[model samples]
Target: MATGPAKDEKCCLVAVTLDKDTIGQGPPDVEHERRVAIYDLLEKNRFVLRDYADEGPYNLRLQIIDRKLVLAVDRQDGVPLITHILSLTPLRRIVRDYFLICESYYAAIRTAMPSQIEAIDVGRRGLHDEGSHLLIERLKGKIEVDFETARRLFTLISVLLWKGQGR
Candidate 1:
């Protein structure tokens, strides 16, 4: 039988903050989504640093600096940990597509038929899952997170990448 980590040994993020400048407020729906992501992530997640496994639950702050994604981590008591950085280049295309699909999904929820709404939702979720996998790949060997955690983090990252009301 396989065993998971003990209760006290579980790792997770206790808090999360996004750079307000980069992730400024936008459409009501978009802003709500960002808030919901943070809420869900804080409500539950698994975040374990590769080399600093035994030191969580941690606090995370994400910032987009110089077109790069900066993942700043710290211990529960605010002690600094690793700051993993990632280039947003690889995620650009997917994030764009995800936004487009989300726009479609939101619009469909109002006027589109049930089947149409379901179809659009399916596509939206597919893109979300793809983005999550990409995030997992991007953070590989640096920070470890499960699929759901990646999904929430991707939400925050997409919000960070948002360009005002343009999209």
Candidate 2:
């Protein structure tokens, strides 16, 4: 009887976990966002290791360990595949800027005119796109994922990083 991750949880290795101990369930809204991101990512994503493509569907665990973002990849049956450690330093500014613009956008939506909301939204989307690209570049040599996958992953990262949670 091998004791480890169950056999039934295997769904082409698309499962992703963000160490609940580290990230917590978060506030209600944040938790909801995280759940949505996970559901959307698993519903459809293209995640493949640069060299270990054949050994997937890969289960991914995203966590901030030792103050660095850690991407631990493994087979569904719990076999270790590859792990990628990325510095949070590169993304700190972008995520910070993203959050700032998000606050402005949220505030504008309730009080500002339609055109003001639209402008803020445009900036928000731009920052989102930029963060996605930066994540892709950071994972360039280690993993192969589509832009959408990167976008979804960035959303999860953003959630985990929300308001002092990165520490």
Candidate 3:
């Protein structure tokens, strides 16, 4: 993770990593390489990527390491489904607005079922272990999120977290 005293503050910025290999026991080296690729991509995009956890492609996972934190949700295929970040300081209202807008992106792809959507909301709120499996199961058939949208959402959310709300 990045070394900075700011990391010690509450929330801080977090990242979650999921790759193709974690879908099953494909290959450790392959998984590592894929993770490396993602880390590299984020860095190339000028975002400071951080290592958080290795939850083995669970529906949801949360981890805090090296002063950084992560909240991630994985797809059934073990790819990264979604991720959100929160920083400690700079408690600017803009950050909250960013989260809300990103949350709209999430809500856009949410299932019609209120309970199921609520479960997803909890997951994004950093309640990973709460209803992860249930949320994943509920999300399988209900949410019809397109791949393009998912990809855009992923990139946008990452950019927002790394660079803040700078247009």
Candidate 4:
């Protein structure tokens, strides 16, 4: 499988795999969040590989190995392309904070006033943005993804982290 995309070629993620052995079984809400993130990512995303032939609709497999996040990219026909191993250490704090904020947001939605819910949502989105930016920075030179794509990927990563923690 080619590693680079062609000139001006646009690529998108078509599939995702999360290793159940490492991540374990998540709760219903976590599973739902994972599904939604993947669906949204597939629905709309711009992913490009540097110095490689541009071909689209890549399949990605996510796994945690030795406390690192492994992103494996493959072709439509299941041919392997490239694998990016990112340190999970940088993501730990943000993921933890994001989950805490999400929990508060959900709780606020259940009983807090509209303003309260909105406030909490704002925090959650901010944390999400931070995490997305970190993801982009971490993936720099390995792969390129737009803000929305990184956001969705960040969501998935958060889910993986949560599941990895057995929470």
lDDT score for residue 71 of model 1: 95
Report the error of model 3 at residue 13, Å: 16
Each prediction's TM-score against the native? 0.91, 0.83, 0.21, 0.88
**TM-score pick, better of 2 and 3:** 2
How many pairs collide in each candidate, listed in order?
A: 0, 1, 3, 7
Stretches > 4 Å off in candidate 4: 1-10
lDDT of 2 by residue, 70-137 (tens): 88998865799888899999998998898788778867977999999999999998998999999999
Q: Compared with the true structure, what per-residue lDDT tens digits does model 4 show for residues 1-167?
A: 11223223347666677777766777777778888887777777777766544655577888888899999887756788888898999989999999889888877878999999999999999999999999999988988899999999998888878866657
Which candidate do you rate higher for lDDT, 1 or 4? 1
Candidate whose lDDT is highest: 1
On a 0 to 1 TM-score scale, where does candidate 3 land against the true structure?
0.21
Q: Which model, 1 or 2, shows the larger TM-score?
A: 1
Error of 2 at 126 (Å): 0.4
Alpha carbon deviation, residue 134, candidate 4 (Å): 0.9
Q: Clashing residue pairs, candidate 2?
A: 13-57
Cα displacement (angstroms), candidate 4, residue 72, comes to 0.5
Cα RMSD for candidates in order: 5.2, 4.7, 18.4, 4.2
Candidate 4 C-alpha error for residue 50, in Å: 1.6
Q: Where does model 3 exceed 4 Å of error?
A: 1-88, 111-167
Question: Residue 79 lDDT in model 2?
Answer: 91
Worst 10 residues of 4 by lDDT: 1-10
lDDT of 1 at 42: 80
Candidate 2 weakest ten by summed lDDT: 1-10
